[model samples]
Target: MPKLIVVAGLLLALTACGKESTPTPPPASQTTQAGSGPVDVNVPVEMRPVLSVDPPAQTPAPAAPDVLTGKDGSTYRVGPSIGDFGRFENVGVEQVDGRWVLNIELPDDTAAIFATWTAENVGKQLAIVVDGELVSAPEIASAITGGALQIAGSFTQKEIRELERAITGK
Candidate 1:
């Protein structure tokens, strides 16, 4: 009797596993509403990586302002690009007393040349350029005779680091 009972239970479980159900469709009115766009069907579909349909076009960025163009159409650039003007011996960011500044060091001969150049071009603006960008253009009030020059831009530590890298080419 117990064996017959177990066989009956097994037959019921096998019949339950064979049962199948059809998905119910939405009502016709909800699917075909007037003046509405096509219904957005939420179905699982295979995803794919997007690819460019057209050929890619590369565009160059605008050049930065480097040369100081004078009213007479004359242009001036620093270092070997121009005249025998002095090279920047050392460029770094340092804290003097309690303030941070970008320091530039020039040799004695170059310092003399810069002093003379500034003194001759007093009242004119000299553009301090970096990586073709005109960072600053201050009027030459007097000659910068001292070989050491400090640039204070009120920049933070990060900005100072970037500026140092830009100026030093490091």
Candidate 2:
């Protein structure tokens, strides 16, 4: 039996079958550009806790620079702390179900941390930061105990490789 899981915030759909879960792309409203952005591409990937989403704050806080304003004019805020499992052990793109998804492998210890964070923060969103930009903000639907995860969004082949290089530092 396949167990379906959702990640990537508003732009993720992944299906798990026999321990292999591949992601599916979201609708047109939300797409991810994990690499190409105006910000410097040298920054490492981080998962910061989302402070707010849509309907921008009445008076933006100090972390205004960290605000992520989408093309649709929706805005969101993320915590300053780099809250995440840890640096990924492996990051690469793969094709599944006719869509491209970013596959991330975490170390056992980091995976444990991720599991805990997810468990505690269910319903909260995480800012998937890649290359110093908010590439995705996926809500935590449930605890992800598995050592791996997939981020589904639109990315060109160049963007995918660029993201991998930035994340892997290779």
Candidate 3:
């Protein structure tokens, strides 16, 4: 019984020592810095100097009201207000009825707004602005009613995503 107790006590002491010897991680701010020479070990673990890195310089964002070239080589000017109708809540582009369409969600009060905008602007270029940039300007083909309208033009995948992002306000 005495030998067994001594062995158990020795095992417990070893386990406790293992648990206590675990190296503590430094604070969140400190990290291993890269250097050409060998790392110095004399410095205190907590006081070891790390690198001070400045964030990447922010480039000036491009100005708005810029003209963008569409896939069909047509130039489109960024419009001041692309979808200002109160009815059109979320406008998006999609394919419907065998043609690519610009879907606009409309409320009850702005039912006639889409028709009026399309009717007055058919054959005239209107800017499809996304993220404050003129993405594409496709001519209004015809006056459309209801909550959906089709915008037909030569559009690439990038242009489609840009237009979708802009229309969705994402």
1 versus 2: better lDDT goes to: 2
Best by lDDT: 2
- Which parts of model 1 are misplaced by more than 4 Å? 1-86
Give candidate 2's TM-score. 0.59
Predicted model with the maximum TM-score: 2
**Candidate 3 residue pairs in clash (backbone atoms < 3 Å):** 87-106
**Model 3, span 1-170: residue lDDT tens:** 00000011011100100111222221122222221122122211110011121222344323334444333333333434534432244455444333333334455444465456655654444544434433334333344456443232334435544544444444
Q: By the TM-score metric, which is better: model 2 or model 3? A: 2
Candidate 1 lDDT for residue 131:
41
Q: Rate the local accuracy (lDDT) of all candidates.
A: 0.37, 0.55, 0.34
lDDT measured at residue 4 in model 1 versus the true structure, 0 to 100:
6
Candidate 3 stretches with Cα past 4 Å from truth are 1-102, 109-111, 151-162
